[model samples]
Target: MMKCKINLNPKMLNLLFLISYVLFVFSLFNRDVSDIDVFYSFTIFAKYISLVLLLIGILAGTYTRKEILWFIVLLCIDFILFIKSGVLVFIIISLFAFHSTKIEDDKIIKLAYFTLLIFTVITFLLLSLGIFNDALTNRWVGDSERHTLGFYHSNVLPLIYSYLVGYGLSSGIYKKNHYMFLIIINFAIYYLCGSRNVLVATLLLIGSKWLIDSFLQKSEFKKMINNILCVFAKIIIPFLSMISLIVPLLMNHIGFFQKLDFILSYRFTAIYKIIQTEGIHIIAQMTNEMYFDNKIVIDNGYAFLAIRYGIVMLIFLSAIIYCIANKYSDNTFVLILIIIVACINFIDNDIIDYSCLPYLIIGEKYVLESFKRRGNNYE
Candidate 1:
């Protein structure tokens, strides 16, 4: 019997991965374009195609014992979720997490940046030209008009902008002036779209980076800052998770919690109601009943993770992110980005959505590199 062999070109595989990722990110732009046949069809096709290519890449590659072990663990969890909820989100994310580490970080970042930037610019232009349908709703932040600008909601566009700002900070690809200009752009996004949480998060992220960089020349200040950040990195995710989980439970009885809930646009209240009505599960439990105002929305990301996806999945994701943040605790900018993203997740649910948190791609690369340095021999 002749041995069968199939040669794979590394460059070709990498190129295909980039294409697949771009398609997925591109599909995000048209998520709300379901009314427009051409754009809607293209977005749906892109999503399915990206998933197919990702699966192909996973099958073609060889996994180490460590990777295989991790996959098995994730698969078991996803299987439970499938059985309980009939949702494929967890499994899909597991595949992406496994496949993402195989591609070069720089290639993925560059392609993702360009793809998202183009989509953002085009969305802006189309909305400005009145060519795109604007979701002119007053549901958020009181009777003020909220503009989605062709996104899934008013918050999404600014969230994407915030992620781009985070990418600029983590990559060190933008200068001080560029970030300064971004502040102006972000304020404009707030003005036009009225997503206050995203605007606040973006500003804090940029300001934090600027202050940290400025303190770099002062050795004592830098050392002190790094020390604080090291501690912050350790607790950020857990802190956010705890607060998100706890706040909702307190929203009704406590005055402070009520004010906080009002400030967060009743996110805690929504989470509380969802938990009350639907109850919690060990694995994810799908909800056909709408949680808030006839809409199935969970604005608190950490709460969404724990409540909707189950506490087990939440802990698993939080641990993965916690490990990554601790791994690069010395890198000030990376630490700050992770912290800020965690804070944003407390206010909004989209933690694993790449368009909303592209920094996860960077985190994924770091994990793979750390594992490779260990030679993948460990159980």
Candidate 2:
């Protein structure tokens, strides 16, 4: 078994985090830039930058010794995918992986790191070279807008999110001037693009996190259940608001940002629109490549893996589920993230996005981290 070890200065480790944020920042400003199929372009580049940071960041995580043969096999997948994403980023990350000292943790983190490393590479290449963008945007010959010189796309989503999340995290007050406007802008972008998956994922994440948090914070079973109900209410808040919309919704009732809240209220309608298009037939056709008469919706992460890879693979792939359940079961955010992944795993382009894979792989470590931070007083 190969040992997972990457030794670097603390400063360097912090720099990696800085770089990761930089990548995310780039994605944010680039999100709205004019380019055909800009959404897909931004997603790839943003993810690519995230992947590179992850590879370097692996050293800071809880990674243990390798499992001989499995490690080699996974490494091969990483190699192939890396070749696909970008040779340069792949080489840098792979080199970092090879040279860095392993931190202490479960096997899942190690595997997740490897899988993400490969996914990052392969995805980068596909987006950069594939003719899909040109075809989708009506630029079969040569679309300059389709390809940004440094990367792809001018405006990006991550940068926008960074500002929103970053401000909220650091300063309690949201930049009402910026994301106050962005709330509608992003909602519009999402509506036009028919990107209902992210919203559904967000709701799932919210519910799970809320439920878990309630389960933990309450002392009595009744309180726990109440908290869980509150979790449900937090999620239902938007849906309920939609109902309120028809009945004269009062501005003073739901806090602030009524317009953004109203946008969220329409989630069901947007989701229904998606349901009409994807149906079962489209799912079966796409899965035919992997199996016979597979009606599974491979667009979702869970479905994608189950159909092509089967139950056995999913068990191994999602091994961290038990870890998270047992330890950080009370973590509302983690719960939400898990739910988000699970719900959308079967709906969107889960196979390509490869977002949930990282969550699954790092689930245990994150669970433990969340649990550790919760303190002993957690009831």
Candidate 3:
């Protein structure tokens, strides 16, 4: 009797990974289905399936020693993370990022576009049908009501819309003429959600793309402008990370910093409170107050990562961002998108929580190049 061997086709693996990815993304954003047993099981199933497929791909494929070392390092970091927080999501996402190295950028873009669209439509439908309630509340006394539109908070709806516009416009999926429609959507989101910061970020996405396109005729000026933006891109993550950490320490002492914190809705104060409560660590540890009862969510992404996920995780994220910035230094649109996201990260915790396209691109550009350099053909 001859032994049998099963060889998984790489293309099929890629297709399966993409499907599982979208399913996982859908599971993440569909708030109503979270309590439903079927969808809850589906989320777990999708995540583990994606993880298994990625593990198989990594083990079966040929890779350089350096690449293997990098994988090991990531595994160790994630293992520490898992031990500390009892969360496997970070490791699963790391595997997804690695698995994405072999896939095409276009595939990720199209799938992300549709996935986000479906999520948005479903959320709206749920809200309209009264299945999901709007988080209508006033943060300050005598303030107007802000609508969440079925999301966890008022800003979430507009933030998701901003990401949709960012992915669509930066990928060239949406044309310049679509800016009017997109801007109208932003205004409507602001009207309903009352998220001014996200509204500005959304408008900046549209305006930056338009400005870049108009100046394309002047190659020298365009190149100069892109160079400036690229430099900003390289430093934005570290700069924001520093500010997120340092601002809280300074806010009480400096009136300017205090006013800035007030403008940011006292995010610095929240950061200070969390720091005083749980404290920062090299590796993120389980907090006594895992679910804060203070009613104010940590809005700063950098602080959230550093405080919640650990300073090491934040550093790892910054390194990944630097890699992306270096890889796309010449791609002005993507760089601008990075800067926009980084700016928003200062106030919003959406960078790693929700967005998938950036990581996919990072894997495509940085991870794929590593394999290619070692004469490994993913195809």
lDDT of each: 0.71, 0.38, 0.73
The digit string of per-residue lDDT tens for model 3 on 262-320 reads 89888999899888877888887754356444443688888887877788876766666
Q: Please, what is the TM-score per model? A: 0.85, 0.40, 0.88
Ranking by TM-score: 3, 1, 2
Number of the top lDDT candidate: 3
Write the number of the candidate with greater lDDT, choosing between 2 and 3: 3
Query: Stretches of candidate 1 above 4 Å error?
Result: 1-5, 32-38, 104-106, 128-131, 139-144, 287-294, 361-379
Candidate 3 pairs with clashing backbones: none
Q: Candidate 2 overall Cα lDDT vs. reference?
A: 0.38
TM-score of candidate 3 to 2 decimals: 0.88
**Which regions in candidate 2 have their CA more than 4 angstroms from the true location?**
1-7, 14-186, 196-298, 307-312, 351-354, 357-361, 364-379
Best by TM-score: 3
